[model samples]
Target: MTTSHKQAPAFRPDWAFLMRHPAHLLAFGFGSGLARKAPGTWGTLVAYPLFFLLLALGAGPLLISLLCVPLFVLGVWACQKTGDALGVHDYGGIVWDEVVAMLLVLAWAPAGWAGWLLAFALFRLFDIVKPWPIGWFDRRVHGGFGVMLDDIIAAGFALAVQALLASWLPV
Candidate 1:
């Protein structure tokens, strides 16, 4: 519902826009990059794994981090295409960016409740602020990697901030 940018293109939300619905959320990821045709499809498809992020991660951080690049790529593309599909830049429903960003932020974070909590807060903050390099990347770049790197950068900033906070606070 919150608009992120003023320059958002003017595409109408389509069936894939239904992916934003809460009912068929699971199915959204199945069609993230698919054409925007069905209701609640892509959003549902992408949202499940996003929901999974706070719950589980059986793999090691390095592996998961590596896995994230492609997913980040996917997120970038998803955001751009979703924007194009809906005629908006950084649409609210295109949370695939948030998904990739959150993962990237925690990719190497300490696996503690405190660390996770701090990371979540810092990540969301940095994402919203788009500070420093995050802002730089968000503004100057274009395309999939462009969409992704700003978040990736913000996540890195959050990681650094969280690490410092963790060290200083020490739960």
Candidate 2:
């Protein structure tokens, strides 16, 4: 008797694929999602430089917060297109959600490295753990909107914890 082996399909996206469409680039967090490990963390880190860039351009925290609205909307469209093309509704490499959500977190996070670091840690924790309603949405929701919603909820959870910590401790 002879046996045949079937190979799993590869889904590795290269720079060419990322550059093929604007939506892919955006949905992939400008290539941050291409990381071999922890693409979501890498994508979340992209928000730091972007936040500083917006600040350098004279946008305050409030303005940065406002910017997240449009960015989130754009992410929805970009992620939808990219997901459709990749045949995965919410692939691990689609990290625009993390970028947008982290941007929102930074907008409300306390000043200085310590605070920012805490915010980053908290955001990542909530995102990865996906507790309560966050898990609810992540499990039940589908498509681009669902892909983005869970991270937004995680950001909210992070911000809430940050607020409580700020009230009790000095960051």
Candidate 3:
């Protein structure tokens, strides 16, 4: 039989397209978001190393929290611009929101890899599952605020779960 080849599906705003704008470059997590699969998860993984570096630099919870505010605020606008360029709101490849939200999670996470692992797992779970008000906002809200809120809400849930785990799990 003759060999048959499968064509790969195209991903949007490929690096060249996103590279035209700095905002898109960042909102795309410096290209981590460009992954053909599970972009958001890749973006979160990108955030992990950065957070570890910050921790190494002795960035305590307060400083990390302080840093997140601006990222969250700026991400709103950056995401909007990138979305407009991509012709889709909150495109899977647009993951600055995940980056900032991860920062928020890490800011409050405990002082070791175990805690970091827990936070990452919890954040990803809540983000993907989108329970309760998170789902509500995801459905009802639109645009940049909408894009960011669900993750923020997910972070809230993750924080709560982390708190509960801290109380009981002794990890």
Give TM-scores for every candidate, taking all chains together and pairing residue i with residue i.
0.68, 0.91, 0.89
How many steric clashes between backbone atoms does each model show? 17, 0, 0
- lDDT against true structure, model 2: 0.87
Q: In model 2, where is the ten-residue run with the lowest total lDDT?
A: 1-10
Q: Using lDDT as the measure, what is the rank order of every candidate, best first?
A: 2, 3, 1
Which window of 10 residues has the lowest lDDT sum in candidate 3?
1-10
Against the true structure, candidate 1 has what lDDT? Answer: 0.58
lDDT of 2 at 93: 82
**Cand. 3 Cα-lDDT:** 0.82
- Model 2, range 1-171, lDDT digits (tens) per residue? 111112211466879989999999999999999998999999999999998898789887789989999999999999888887777777788899999999999988887787788889999999999999999998787778888999999999999998888654465
Per-candidate Cα lDDT values, in order, are 0.58, 0.87, 0.82
Task: Put the candidates in TM-score order, highest first.
Answer: 2, 3, 1
Cα displacement (angstroms), candidate 1, residue 123, comes to: 0.5
lDDT winner: 2
Model 2, position 33, has a per-residue lDDT of: 92
Question: Which pairs, if any, clash in model 3?
Answer: none
Report how far residue 110 has shifted in candidate 1, in Å.
2.1
| Model 3 agreement with the true structure over 1-171: per-residue lDDT tens digits | 111111222444787977799989888998999898899999888788778888899898889888888888888888877777666776788898898898889888876778888899999999999889898888777677777888988998999889888755444
